[model samples]
Target: MSEPIPTGCEGVDELLGGGFERGVVTQLYGPPAAGKTNLALSAAVETAARGDSALFIDTEGISVDRLEQLASARTEDVEDLASRIIVSDVLDFDEQGEAVQDAEEFAEQVELIVLDSATGFYRIRRTEDEEAGDALRTVAQQVTHLLSLARKHDLAVVITNQVFTDPDSDRARPLGGHTLTHWSGVVLRLERFRGGNRRATLEKHQAKPAGETIQFKITGEGLQSVEDVP
Candidate 1:
């Protein structure tokens, strides 16, 4: 059998059946202000706190200062955790591929690699009038390359994605659609719930059967497990 994946949060780890399985790509999708970045940051902090190095590739200009503030405000050993975290930004496919390769090489010494706002990496290639097919193809190639890196290196890959509203369809969907959904081993959707709380629902997973949804809260410390909303 394959090794179990580790979710950075204890509560989440239990829910995920030990942890996210190693050597698989997990996608975290949410709309703007849905606490997606917070989840990623929390995971990175947790990984580093466990003495495992983590690399974060930022495509949306995720503020390093904000990460520092969050780390200092929440973690017990902020300085030590911060020391284990690394950040990179990729502006195009070429740069992104190089970053993924570098990250894979780095993963030999680390436990996790996070692509913060993975979808935004494709924005560099988008034109105002670009066709949907072309955009999908571009994103597919990038996801494929990243997944290969993750598997080859035996490291967990977590990618954050932006959600898009479907005007005609009632169901909410991710921006990259099937290309991303198919490539990923797990797909999670995050959203704000009542009382300003947020929920992380399992939209899809291949390892084991998962329920429709799960709930979590965002505190100044980061995401914490909450009772699932009925």
Candidate 2:
């Protein structure tokens, strides 16, 4: 088995028994302000730092300032590290799906593939109940493509997602549901907690039992794990 990609976040890595697994799709889902994107960026840095290029499909714009802050610990030349990540800015859901589907053309060149917020445009176009199911089907199909692409190339795939909340019960869950979750071998959910800390829950995994969690804060440098978090 290939070694897991160590996300610089200390505690969370320990929780996963090393880091994110390669040759499979891992889903990171969370509500707004839960730091799902922060964790995704951290993975890109870790994966790209391994001496190979990475592909970052940016549905939401990435912050170079944040990259500089996060990459500073690993290399003096943040620009060099940043350069290793080939970013594709996708404006709409159709464009997003195309970017993910077409990634196979360059699969051999990258070690890590990240789609930050796979559901950004998905939610926008599917706001009404009638269109949500079709949107979900499209997302699920695209994720399956990513799953096959990851295994075919032995790449570590990370896709961030937003949650859908039901007004009746005030319950929130990952938007794509079982259809999307099935494709990911590992699923981690981020939840906002008190005092600027985020809780990362291991919802599904191959080795580690589910429901184990860790708390961390987004620092100037990157994510810092907390102790005795509430």
Candidate 3:
């Protein structure tokens, strides 16, 4: 078995039994400003800091400025840190799929792969219920392909997803439907808390019981795990 990749956030690492497991797909689903991107960047920084390269696929226009800031905080040489991170800006669903599928060329170089807002383009094109469902189906298939690559190459795949609130229950659910849920090996739901803190709930894990939560904060340095979080 491959060793887990540490995410740099102590609390999250502990919750995940060190960090994200290799050869599986991990999904971080939540609402806007829930610190999903922060966590993703934190993982990338940790991966790069360990002398391993990371592939970051940006779908929702993730801020490069913010990434640079985080990278600066994590390492002394921001340029070297940036060099290890291969970023691909994907504008549409087709491009997103292509980027993910074509990542094999970098498989030996990249140990961790991140897709920020994997469902962003699908959500944007979803005008009607039928269209939304169809888009989701397509996206799910693409995600499965990505996961297969992860398993084949022993890469850790991390995907950030957007969520929608159910009108009847007022409960937030990941946008990609049950198919997406089933594809992911680990599922975490991020939420905002008081005092600029964030909460991450481990909703599904292949080896562990669900409903475990962890606390962390996005700081000037990066995502830090809060000790004895209340």
Off by over 4 Å in 3: 128-130, 228-230
Q: What is the C-alpha RMSD of each candidate to the true structure, in Å?
A: 2.6, 1.6, 1.5
Clashing residue pairs found in predicted model 3: none
Candidate lDDT scores, in order, read 0.73, 0.85, 0.86
Q: Which candidate is the best by TM-score?
A: 3
Record all residue pairs in model 1 with backbone atoms less than 3 Å apart, i.e. clashing: 5-19, 5-20, 5-21
Question: Residue by residue across 140-187, what tens digits does model 2's lDDT show?
Answer: 888888888889888888999888887877888888778778888999
Worst 10 residues of 2 by lDDT: 125-134
Worst 10 residues of 3 by lDDT: 125-134
What's model 1's TM-score?
Answer: 0.86
Instruction: Write down the TM-score of every candidate.
Output: 0.86, 0.94, 0.95
| Residue 219 error, candidate 2, Å | 0.8
> Can you give the lDDT of residue 60 in candidate 1?
71
lDDT of 3: 0.86
